[model samples]
Target: MSVEVLSFGCRLNAYESGAMRELAVGAGHAGTVLVNTCAVTAEAEKQAAQAIRRLARERPGVSVVVTGCAAQIAPARWSALPGVARVIGNADKLKPEAWALDAAPAPVSDIMAARGVAAYPVADFANRARALIEVQQGCNHRCTFCVIPYGRGPSRSAPVGAVVAQVRAALEAGCQEVVLTGVDIASYGPDLPGAPTLGQMARRLLALVPELPRLRLSSIDPAAIDDDLWRLLGNEPRLMPHLHLSLQHGHDLLLKRMKRRHSRADALAVAARARRLRPGIALGADLIAGFPTEGEAEFAATLDLVGEAGLQFLHVFPYSARPGTPAARMPQLPMAVRRERAARLRAAGAERAQQFYAARMGEEEAVLLEHPDRGHTEHFCPVRLAAPAGARGQVLRARVTGADARGLLAEAA
Candidate 1:
């Protein structure tokens, strides 16, 4: 009769799923099936809906509750689905009482009205090597191609004290690393008391949690980095040297149409600055392909950005037009064209990644072994090693031996 959670989308959702599990179990609704969804792309929502139907069929008679960005934005649509017993908003999903039978069958609320983030207390991440601490919630900017702002509400910061406590709890629970995550992490703290910057938050967290061994950040906007955080990139070795940026497009015109804040020049500058501050740091970015008016020349700029930005890890998304987004109303590109451009970007990303791994073939790195056969380096590059059974969840020194399309191969040092 235990509650089961099926999570999809970002690492933040994964963290929230864990919290939801705790809430469900604590509320004594052990037989409920929770389908946490993502609404980033139309395809993501489609998959979530499909999964929901499959789960309901397989686990008959159980109350199937759907939540997450997809459900939050379109509660009526999901509620009408065959097997869904209820639909909850992103804002209400974390509340313990929301899991009770007396809770509304469709508990969607005005997520935009939420002034602050509710701290969903979690004791542990059952099988994670690292824990995610959500320091912010929602987004203030309305990127032309995004629907997440409406789903998540305005930006709200968890008090710095609450964040520190969460990290401390994670460390005490034996997590090796803690990743600070949010929808738009770089925009953190704008709504809080002092309107402290993300950089200031990072500095304070590290300084206050002196025993914290590794602190990582989720995807950030290049335009929002503050001076204090930038300095820490150079001085703090514990602030893991991997930065994943949200760089939607490489061409200025496309970027402008997408309502992005940074220019291509700004991206290149950040890449250079990261490397200068921390040698051998891994740079990752999220890039999209085949925007409405993107020409071959525009596509070429994005392809060239793989090298120009020195991106070692890339997440390339084929543009999918969401119904309400501004880009959706613009002249749409053919699906085939979008996918082909995405493939090209991925190929370039692979080439750069291999080059980065090859350069580290003879170097020594501290690998955090998440599994018996796999782990990642401080730069967040995947490394394959035959780790001892006892070494899982432990960080060990390793010497790299080779690189291939898969990842770097290493031997325990």
Candidate 2:
């Protein structure tokens, strides 16, 4: 029998799905395919549904299983969709062998995760400059606008040993870059007894492969990072000089409404300190525009803080109401207003990114050369060129000459 698990959204889901694929292949199933799914935004959800429909239309009789945040959040919605012969929740996906005797079982697991894997190993097929390593699951913070916690449950972490194992595997798989991901990466170790902090986890991962290049932490909370973490980052050769601290809003009032732990000033201080340690480090943040009850001044402050904090990348999101969230109940701005804000913020982000890339022009950048089929770069900014006269997975020093709307433009210096 042929079985394929379709997973969606987030690196944790990726790790889980990878483990599931490994399970299928190990079980001697030759027609196993795992389709990873993502639904962070409505666009992601639409793509996933379209994929399911296409698969159903093109291939019949192949056992299809749907799993991940999208599946967990709306079981009935996904189950009702065609082509999904089985619906497994993320909680039980990794342990498919335990779910049923049939090589392809239907409705294997629900909202709960399946941790029935001897090892959570991922395929080394990613062509990007960085690899996303999931060390944790779930989120403790129930931000009014997010449905992650509702779908993923409270925070749970992979064993530290397992994390190190994964890191080593990624390195051996020829990934020069690694980014640790989770719904709440900052809350990584609390579930484990005497769990290591985010910084400690990075420290250990780097220690395992001291020569490992370009290690990064993803979407960490400003409040979670401290002097010790900064010191570790500054001292570590492998850790990248970039931080993506999630600042949902810049105004204190808006932050309160979002139930974020850190205020604007606190987030600013974190940026200041990080820059102090490494002038080359790129700072990034996620801003929500036209949020409920967000006044003109609140939005203005958000814009102001991006400049004030000197973010390298601004991921601006327009407010959208989900079915089960407090923000959905709150009075939202009109569609026109939300879209206008989003358009303006997106433009601003583009200009800022252009300026950031421009500054690197004529400067020496240590780029981790990746396969040129996509783009390649040392910094996260990607660039496309005619397939370079070289193989993939090689890092080179390139001097930035200009900016491509996509990323940076450069040549061998």
Candidate 3:
């Protein structure tokens, strides 16, 4: 059997999994099950462990190698898990030599000492319409509630030439859209010579890879968006209009307590600026529904921000306390409160999403066909075609016919 990768967590993890699969196969590791894990929340780690055990149980003789944020942070725990053949760290997972059949069973390294992100270009992602190019790696900021920095290490960017090459490879492989992803994409370029901003690098990439149909960015910090990126949002047609902000909370006090770089006012300003620059641009955010010391008023503030910021999409988390994080040491909210607040926030987001989708009725959109009957619009809204439109990876101009609870309904124009 071919080597299989089970990935968890962010888009970056998904991207890395593709690279890891290629490496494992190239290194002649057949019949291997690679578990790429996430450490964003305790639940995320728990799910990964469960998957590892299940995979082991189902494929009794297969080799299971664990890697990713969770494995990088706790190699001993993952290695001790039944049927795990090896445990690799984030820093070594992408390196070709680490995937060798004879490589050490557990060679997890010191992530904090890592200083650069080398481009591991993946030509294609299995069953994915969009290709993900990891523009940067790790993170420097230490948010009170986030353990990702510890798992990932310091911020480091892939060189501009490397990124362009990766994008070109994806285009050649018939990907219609490419998303530049990372742990903290907004913090790209400071480590590189000339210190080109994320926007500057993007501008260059588009110019170099003019054949690329659509370019998108993964979640970005509202506090760190550069002027060049803002200009791209305003003028670049190929750069998609959807922007997802890493806005943890909407309350100023909660924002401060979380040690986030941006304030409530700053987040509002960023959203307003994005809309002003690109009219009809779809906006989304990552919001923590309940945090340490969160009360009714604080939760309400975050709920209100959904409409206030015109957020059409939301990634809401019910504040899972990660061990060793500062927030875990603080007074914690009840699990019931956290889950309830999360439901409320998700409900608000769904309501706003329906509104956004309804507003797009009759508008012409460029839809990238991920499936024969379904794809997503330029705004990243899911659209179910009235009929089989085109082959997967083909871009079609379509007219929005209706909207529903799932997403927009469209027909090819």
Candidate 4:
């Protein structure tokens, strides 16, 4: 079987797909591939469907398996689609070996952390410059809008020691940077014996690997950051200064309806503190434009607050309630309304992003040289340089040449 895996949705899906690929190869069906499914939104469903059709056209009757949030939510829908030989829910992931086309993998008697921690593969991905290590999986918080916790099993955290081991392994494998990812990364280490928080995990990792080149964090819940975390992050050069905070709504009333723990003031306080503690820090945010009963006044307040928050890059997405969540029962804005709101927020975000890039025109920022092909700036701005291939790993002080429709350009300073 000629196996090729396609993943959709969050980093957890990537981790699960990676593990599935590893086990399939070990089962003597080395060539067989897996098609991972995603279910973040309705758009994700359409994309997964299109991908399935493309895979079926390429190789008919291959052992195509679909799994993840999409499959979990609507297995019959995916199973009915062409080219998918099997559909596995979260329960099926309990034993990845069983899904193999032929022979099952031998159970490992002695394992690190727990037996299922490595349920997903983490091998043969040496080509990428950045590796995302999913430190935890699943979410416990019942955020009214999210479907992830239901899609994944009860919240599970990889062992802290196991996570550190993975980090060390990725570093040894020549990865330039490691991004700690998960559905709810702030809830990391909760399922383990000790239940250390994300801040503690980060502190421990920084202490353990004193010389690790770069440590990047995925978006974190504002409620999770504490005084200890801010203090630890203040002088840590290895820890990336860029922080992506998820602030879905700006109104305290809307936040309450969304079931988020933090209030509007709470989020603003965290962002303000992070900026004050770290000067010239790049702060990013994820904002939802339209949710149930989010009137024009509420939306306007959100826009006002976003500007006041001093956000650099904003990922503005309109709300879509998934089934099995509390928000689905709530009155939904029409598709036209959703689309219109999304467009307005997106336009605002683009203007803000342009301003941010423009401000960095004369400043010298550390560029983590990704590859001869493409790379990203520390602030998540896309960058391309006139430098040579040797500039892959070295941090180059690049002078911003220009910011076009595509991205910012730089010359070696």
For all predicted structures, in order, the TM-scores are 0.97, 0.89, 0.98, 0.90
Task: Look at candidate 4 and give me any clashing residue pairs.
Answer: 3-31, 3-32, 3-33, 4-33, 18-121, 19-120, 19-121
Report the error of model 3 at residue 389, Å: 1.2
User: Against the true structure, candidate 1 has what lDDT?
Assistant: 0.88
**Ranking of predictions according to lDDT:** 3, 1, 4, 2
Clashes of each: 1, 15, 0, 7
Give the Cα error of residue 383 in candidate 2, in Å.
3.1
Q: Tell me each candidate's RMSD, in Å, in order.
A: 1.3, 2.9, 1.0, 3.7
Best model per TM-score: 3
**Candidate 2 ranges with C-alpha deviation above 4 Å:** 1-8, 28-35, 58-62, 96-119, 123-129, 373-376, 385-389
Q: What are the lDDT scores of the predictions, listed in order?
A: 0.88, 0.72, 0.91, 0.73
Q: Indicate the residue-level lDDT of 125 in model 3.
A: 60
Which parts of model 4 have CA positions greater than 4 angstroms off? 91-96, 103-116, 119-121, 387-394
Model 2, residue 196: distance off in Å is 1.5
Which candidate, 1 or 4, would have the higher TM-score against the true structure?
Answer: 1
How do the residues 288-371 of candidate 2 rate in per-residue lDDT, one tens digit apiece?
889899888888888788788888787777887777888889998997887788787777777777878888878866677666
How many backbone clashes can be found in candidate 3? 0
| lDDT value, residue 327 of candidate 3 | 94
lDDT string, candidate 3, 20-41, tens digits: 8999888898889999999998
Best by lDDT: 3
